[model samples]
Target: MLKRQKRSITTTLLTTLFICSLSITAHARRSGGPTPSITATPVVIEHIERNLSSLGSLKANQSINIAPQIGGRIVSLMIDDGHFVTQGETLLTLDSREQAAKVNEAKITVKDAERQLSYMVKLFEKRAVSQDELAAQEAQVERAKANLSSHMANLDYYTVTAPFDGVLGFNDLSTGAMITAGSNITTLDDLSTMKLYFELPENTFSEITTGTIIQATTDAYPDHPFTGTIDAINPRIDPVNLTFSARASLDNTNNQLRPGMLMRLNVVRPTIATLVVPARSVLFDGNDQYVYILDEEGLPQQRYIETGIILENKITITHGLAEGDYIVDKGVVKVTAGRPVKILSTEIAENHLDTVEPAGDARS
Candidate 1:
């Protein structure tokens, strides 16, 4: 009877201990002790832009090397280096005392010829000369007038004038310096606007057109971006490189950009409304790309996705995602499919949200 009582007490004690262990296990499971914590953001529907990038060079809207049309000794320098000049403004003058004397002589000859022609006409009317003789005298008067006009035109060449409104450049010529015809005296550039020349592959010819927007950056002004429009496109592709040339014009009201500077161009293509997610949310597994999304039951569901262009830490989802879907934007590698997750907070994912205001609120 004593041995039976001892055995029954041992059995009861073992049963109580087993029941306590089962209760503890159930409590831990209900409280989610094994669930992983993560940050999540909703997929956004926004406009995604694609850009075509290329290198280019900046140039002045109009540039020219000023030279003289006639050779002579420089007598006066009307413009200084880097002077802003207007159209038809006198730039320099050459010594032309000899040319001036030739013009005066031609004028005197013209007067003499006119007097002789008049005297001859009167003599012919009185029968002092024949009709043919009067005609010959009239021809002499015309020849003298032509000679005078030629001399007058040659005298005008002694002065050089600006062809357009622009800023002047430096020149070696000075007062009393002898220069030859066609010699470069200086340069002029119109800085109110600038031009950019770049090339793209011939395959993109159809996509580029006049009035397309362009944004450009240069090392000289890295922080500032210049905007312009496509002004022209080459009609034929270059046979050597199979590329087409494009030109864009931008305002240079401040005259900051200079010719020959290297620039990087971004040609903005049309945008499309699409679904996007944070770049961090996408994961790569060999040839496949995927993300972890929260299902209706709050469990992780692996989703394979197709991606397009990426910009500003955001990526476009071409397939396998929808607007308003939630994805694991942070701590993606820590969780797997069907795993229970606890979202820590929404603050961390605020930046990845679509911030576009509704149309009704926009009007207000």
Candidate 2:
């Protein structure tokens, strides 16, 4: 009988433990723990105008290779590298001793021919000379005059002068160096104005035009910002790159900008109303870019966004989204689509002034 009583006691204890386990499981299911806390704010969205961007180079407005027109020994080099010169300034002189002598001899011959022609014409009037003799004298005068002009031109070719007002580069050919015609002596570049050349996509053909403003900067001069405009646009697009060339003209009168300097161009394209968003909120996945949209219950919905030009931390949303849509910036990792969210006090919304206000009650 005592053994029967022990078995009954053990059975009662086991049954009570099973009932307690069931009660705890039911209580835990009812509580479900603390949900993820997320914060959101309602902000008025404005569509921003998009700007185009490209890389370019600073160049002299005009540059020409200075070459001698006649082959001769360089007698003197009047200017060195980095020399500023004016138009018609003598840059160098070639050995023109032979040319000068020939010019003088031609002049003497021309004078003698003119005197002989005068005498022949007087004789022809008196019938003392035949028509054939008069013709010969006239021919001699014409030939001498032509020879004199030719020699004069040859003498002028011995001196090389600046074709325009500009700065000269180093004279690669030294004095007393024998140079042939068309050999490069130096480079003359007009730096009073600078021109930047860059190529853009064919889609910008209609949007860009003359007088469009541009902002430029260079590594050489970091402190200054160069302002310019669209001076010219190429009439045809390149078949290989499918891009058209664009030029920006800037005043370099102070000689601050130099040629061959790499530059960055901020070209503003035709503005179109676009939804703007903070760049940090956008996320990229493989080939597509996306952002998280907060639903009415503070849940997350994944959205793919097409991005346009990027300005600092802001980016223009070209497509795939609309204005006045709530975006979940923080707590995106913990939240999933269609899940209920409980907003906590630790999260903050961005880009909204009122949302960022310190949470302090005036009455307190």
Candidate 3:
């Protein structure tokens, strides 16, 4: 009986120990920390086309200032603001009575000198007049002709004409307004074809070329987008501003685009092949940028990267990362190196692997 009791005690102790061991294991599993939630984006090779945006103003390709070369009282204004005039069209007519009288007087003097010169030449030919006298008569005729031509030009200046085909501004001088020579009367701007001019930073000098497409917009017309090609570029950079001038030609047949209106320009630079990821995947610490990449075991590993400009809500990675990498967009803060991860959805995990794969390539 003692031997039986000893064997039974031994068996009971063994069983209790086994049960306790099982219970401890189960409790430890139950107390296992909660699984972390995370969001992720697959790294992919995308064409990274960058753009530089700037603000500019609309300007007419040509602008003309209407000013009289001769002083006179304004007799009439043939054109006003918003009036379209053709080239050589008379814009205004000034009082030219004085100029016309001067021209007539000069013409009479020229005719008298011509008659006197002819008489002197005939007398010289007949040996009745000295050669010196004939030369003096010829000089008098030339002087009178010059004076007449000057009066004729002054008379033409009295009648102001449009220098080019353009729209005129408001009349700066009204009838009976006394004006001096070179005084501005009105302005004419050619609006048929408008040009957009702007400056770019010196660093982007070599990247731009003629015929590069540019997109422009304005607050005045929110829905309309204007497209144009680079017409020209300044070869020399402005030392003070450290920029270069660029021009874009635009069509304005309807005359809707006016000069002095503000505009914004978007210039596309050269396209580059690079790896890109969602913007949320990037984290910055001071000047350093970093991301959480997955290791072979699906554990989070920190990667420091050099970044370029952001393109279309995606960050362009210049270095320290490559295509086919898996980055955690979310839940990165809770991750540590060498930690094990159990993927909740195998499809999501597989898709992440497939992200960088070219088309028609399957993920293993």
Candidate 4:
């Protein structure tokens, strides 16, 4: 019975040893196989831009409060609300009866003065009047002409005309309503283009210029983001806030935008040429950022890198990378440092990825 138990134990031990040896041989065989290929891309130069946000407001390109030039009772209202009117188009007509009668009276007086002046000229030529007497008659005619011109100019004041081409706002007053000089008649604004007002910190003022483009969104139309170009910058900076004001203009021929719309602006700083790589290639551990780059022998090596503003899924490599350096862009997680990798193929970048500039595009 002892011998049989011992034999059973020996058989079990021998079986375990055989299986272990077989497993080790299988692993060795698999390890000797070809190295797996990795997807790599060259670090290329790209223009990376930083984004900034600010709260702003929209305004009309040209806006004015329409008012009458003189006081009178309204006889006619030619203004059509919410419609565009050309410059010099009659907007309102006041009761011109008194003004017209005054103009006619002045005209008759001018004619009578001219007749007397002619008679005086004929008498002076015949030596029947002294030079001083004739000069006085000529002065009378001149005074009468001046008086007529004054009345005629005043007569034009009874009709209100537009200062420029613009769209009219609603007017509460109607015909026969009395208004004084400089009283509110309505509002007019040039809506062909809109002015966008915004402010930025003084630190970034160096990066901004007159042609810099700004993209904006309004709460009223969140989906429709519009764009404008910086046309003017206020030379004065806010003393307390340390910010400077800027103005941009955008096309608004359809009149979709108006004055005083709260807008959120997105300003892109000037782009700089720097080495860039795909965002997916980077891995973060603790606070250390790193990537797997291939050496000249196509061996995987772990490299630490510094990154900057990411635009359009491309990260700007501020450190630890240079243009033309090959890095694993796909299946980066599977790569092990110091491991050899086969050359599957290099991804030749045809065009650099970039953010589409919102300036000079068709109106939204």
Candidate 5:
């Protein structure tokens, strides 16, 4: 009887220990700490835009070199360097003494011819001169008048005048300095507007058109961006470079922009409806791109996606994602496929869904 009791007690102790071990294991699994905390955002469906960046040059709206049409010794410099001039204002003058003398001689010849023609007319009326003789005398008077007008027109060439209203540059010429025809006396520019010249690839010809808006920036004023419109475009692509030229014009009311300055330009095409998510949600594995999305069971699920253009803090999802899908926005590093995730906050996801109105069921 004593041996039987000892065996029974031993078996009871072993059974109790086994039950306690199973209980501990169950409790540990139940407590498994807290799920991995993560922040998530909902995929938004809205209009997304793509911009084309290019380098270009700034030019004056209108620029020309001020020079005399005819060569002569500059007798007068009416305007100083950097002077603002109006259209038709005289800027310089050549010596006109010789031209004046020729004009005066032609005037004397005209007077002489007129006197003779008057005498011949009276004589013809009195029958002392023939009709042919009187007509010959009349022709002389017309010939003299033509000569005088010719000299007067030539005399006007001695003056140099502004062709348009603009600011003038410095000229090396002064009084008594001789200059040849077509020599640059100075430069004049209309700074009311500026032109930006840039080129785009031939494939973009169909997308670009007149009146397209563009934004331009320069190193001189990095903080300020200048807005412009497409004023013109080349009709044909350049075979050598396989590009087409485009010109844009912008207001320069402050005169801050100048010609020949390097400019960075951005042209945005029309916007299209696409699905987008925060850039931080995307993860790269080898050559494949993916993101972590919440499945029906509130677990992290790996989804491979194809992406399109990336702009600002958002990326366009071309494939493998739907509108209203929740993605891990932050703490994606701690997320693993098929693992339960504790959502720290869904406020961002809700806000995105509420703000972005669904345009359509479009992938890109």
Candidate 6:
């Protein structure tokens, strides 16, 4: 009899607990769930950009391989490696004994022709020479002068001179070494300035232009960053790469930069108008991203958003959200759809050039 009474008490207790749970669930359903405390922020039109980073190649303002035009035995080398030379400075010389003899012989022939022409003029005046003969003598003198000029020009080929003011590279050829014509004797580079060559995608056509600022750094000197402006842009786009090449000139008066050094560059494009929201306010679920947007009824609603580049702590909203729309910025995790939120605070966007958002009241 005592065991039966104990069973009856246990059943009563279970029934009472079930009834209380039902009542609580009914009350919650009527109330539409609990309200969450959150901070709301209106989307703002902000200036944002994704800085472009690219690899570039460094080159001197002017660079060339120093070579001789004529082949002969090298008799002299006036400058060594790493030496600065001015334009038209004699750099190297080849054996010119035979060339010098030819020039002297040509000069003698010119003088003889001139002397004969002067005697022919006198003979023609005395009627001892025909008019045709006198004309022939004058033509011989002209031909002799042309021959002399040619020999003199050939004589200058034996000597090599600096083409411009620049720094010299290594000279492997020593004096008295036999070298062929067009053999590379050394290298010369005008390092007063540097040219940075890089490519940009065709999409940056409107944003990137002459006078765009760019910063570059080389692995050789990472700490030192070089700054320059885009001075030249290739008008033609590369058909294969779909990119256009640009040239930036940086002042290297100290001669710190060298040609052929691989450099990294950053294109500092100007920021443009874009819709932005706080990065922390956005939540990602698989491939879709969403944020809690407060509705006219003060209830939180789940709104999916498409995002673009993120700068600082703000993310760009490309679609699904417009400027001046309110979103749950703080306490987003606690926000539930169709549930009212306690307005802890708010941040509203001001449509002005100043761009600073004024704070809202903190009181709920």
**After superposition, which runs of candidate 1 have C-alpha atoms over 4 Å from their true positions?**
1-42, 49-56, 123-139, 199-227, 237-244, 262-271, 283-305, 324-364
Per residue, candidate 6 scores C-alpha lDDT tens digits across 1-364 of: 9999999999999999999999998798677775555677889998766678889998999999988888999898887789899999999999999999999999999999999999999999999999999999999999999999999998999989988999999977788899998999889999999999999998887778899999999988899999999999999998899899999998997778999999899999877899999998999899999998866666678999999887778999999898878888877887677765666552322222132223443322
Model 1 per-residue lDDT tens digits across residues 1-364: 9999999999999999999999998787666565555777889899867789999998888999988889999999987899889989999999999999999999999999999999998999899999999999899999999999999998999999998899999987779999999999999998889999999989889999999999999999999999999999999999999999999998999888998999999998998898989998899989999999877665679999999878789899999999878888666776768766556435423432332111211110
TM-score of model number 2: 0.73
Model 3: CA > 4 A from native = 1-32, 236-242, 344-364
lDDT of 2 by residue, 151-260 (tens): 99999999999999999997666789999999998899999999999988998788899998888889887778888999999899999999999999998977888889
- Per-residue alpha-carbon lDDT of candidate 5 for residues 267-286, written as tens digits (9 for 90 to 100): 97888999999888899999
Which candidate gets the maximum TM-score versus the true structure?
Answer: 3
Give the clash count for model 4: 0
Model 3: which ten-residue window has the lowest total lDDT?
A: 355-364
> Against the true structure, candidate 1 has what lDDT?
0.86
Q: How accurate is candidate 2 locally (lDDT)?
A: 0.80
Give one clash count per candidate, in the order shown: 0, 0, 1, 0, 0, 0
Model 3, residue 148: distance off in Å is: 0.9
lDDT of 3 by residue, 116-218 (tens): 9989988999999998888999999999999999999988998999888999987756788888899888899999888999999999988899999888888
Show the colliding residue pairs in model 2: none
- Model 2, residue 193: distance off in Å is 1.4
lDDT: worst 10-residue window of model 6: 348-357
Give the lDDT of residue 159 in candidate 3. Answer: 92
Flag the better candidate by lDDT, 2 or 6.
6
TM-score of each prediction: 0.67, 0.73, 0.81, 0.64, 0.69, 0.78
lDDT of each: 0.86, 0.80, 0.81, 0.83, 0.85, 0.85
RMSD of each: 14.6, 10.9, 13.4, 14.6, 14.4, 9.6
lDDT of 1 at 319: 97
lDDT of 2 at 281: 68
